[model samples]
Target: MGVLFYGSAEHAIEIDDVALAHLKVVIATKLRRNESFTLSWMHDSGQPLGRSTIWLHPSIELRFAFEEPTPPPLDPAKIQAYANSANTSGGILVPEEHILGSSRGVVLTA
Candidate 1:
């Protein structure tokens, strides 16, 4: 499992390492261009039993932590799909497998 620390360490969101890897690519690409967008996901478990969305911007601190020391390989198809959603007005929705139905490890802090 990987953790995505957004804003502060206390606000860490746990996610699969592979999924986080893909998210990192998409997020990095958008922030590199100074773009801000919403990242939405459905919370099937946890305190919130519904959907959640976060505003991702260059100003906000974001970190991706993986259980493994080495980073997983990147999938171009996944990156493209994520980038496409992120570019849309609605922004990017996480649980990326839903976007590409396809299928990693590392602690990448950004």
Candidate 2:
């Protein structure tokens, strides 16, 4: 899995491919419209929340890692089953344990 770093320190906010793609689109759209602000997301662990300030630019790389093998496809039925299980918590879109494996990419505009 890839690690997110802030300068020299590692961050707790690990973004997977699916989330990363969506983020890129959202940011790009906003940037194209000349919008600049902070975007925040709460972590699944619930202990640490994270945010980043986004700006319009052609140079930002939108960095992420795809070094790990892809995870098994998520079955909606299985997702539902585990969602209701006593061991699980509700409200997260994609479960944290598998975030790095199931990410997709988005095309960017110059």
Candidate 3:
């Protein structure tokens, strides 16, 4: 799992590294353009219950930490899809498979 330390207070949000990497790109792009959006993800057993959403803005500090030293290879098509979805009212939805123990590492859809 990866940790996204968000804002000045550094509230940590745990996410899958691969998924976080994809989100990093889209998030950077949006923030660069001064766009704000919410990132929603389903909670795994470790979390309390239900899903969580965070509003991202350029002014806020964000950090991504991965367990693996090296970054994962990202798919352009998938990134584009994520970016497209982010532009919508719902923003970006982190797929269940990306979360730990949600899909047993088998990707059905994102």
TM-score of each: 0.80, 0.36, 0.81
Instruction: Answer with 2 or 3, whichever has the higher TM-score.
Output: 3
Poorest lDDT segment (10 consecutive residues) of candidate 1: 101-110
> What is candidate 3's lDDT per residue for 21-99, written digit by digit as tens?
8878999999999999998877766556787778888888888788779988999988998899899999998777666
Give candidate 2 misplaced runs (Cα > 4 Å): 1-12, 46-64, 67-110
Alpha carbon deviation, residue 28, candidate 3 (Å):
0.5
Top TM-score model: 3
lDDT of 3: 0.76
Point out the higher-scoring one by lDDT: 1 or 2: 1
Question: What are the per-model C-alpha RMSD values against the true structure?
Answer: 5.9, 11.5, 4.1
Count of backbone clashes, every candidate in sequence: 0, 4, 0
Which has the higher lDDT value, candidate number 2 or candidate number 3?
A: 3
What is the lDDT, from 0 to 100, of the residue 85 in candidate 1?
89
lDDT of 2 by residue, 1-110 (tens): 33222233234345544444444455455546654434333333333344232232334434444325664344455434333331223222333343322222111111
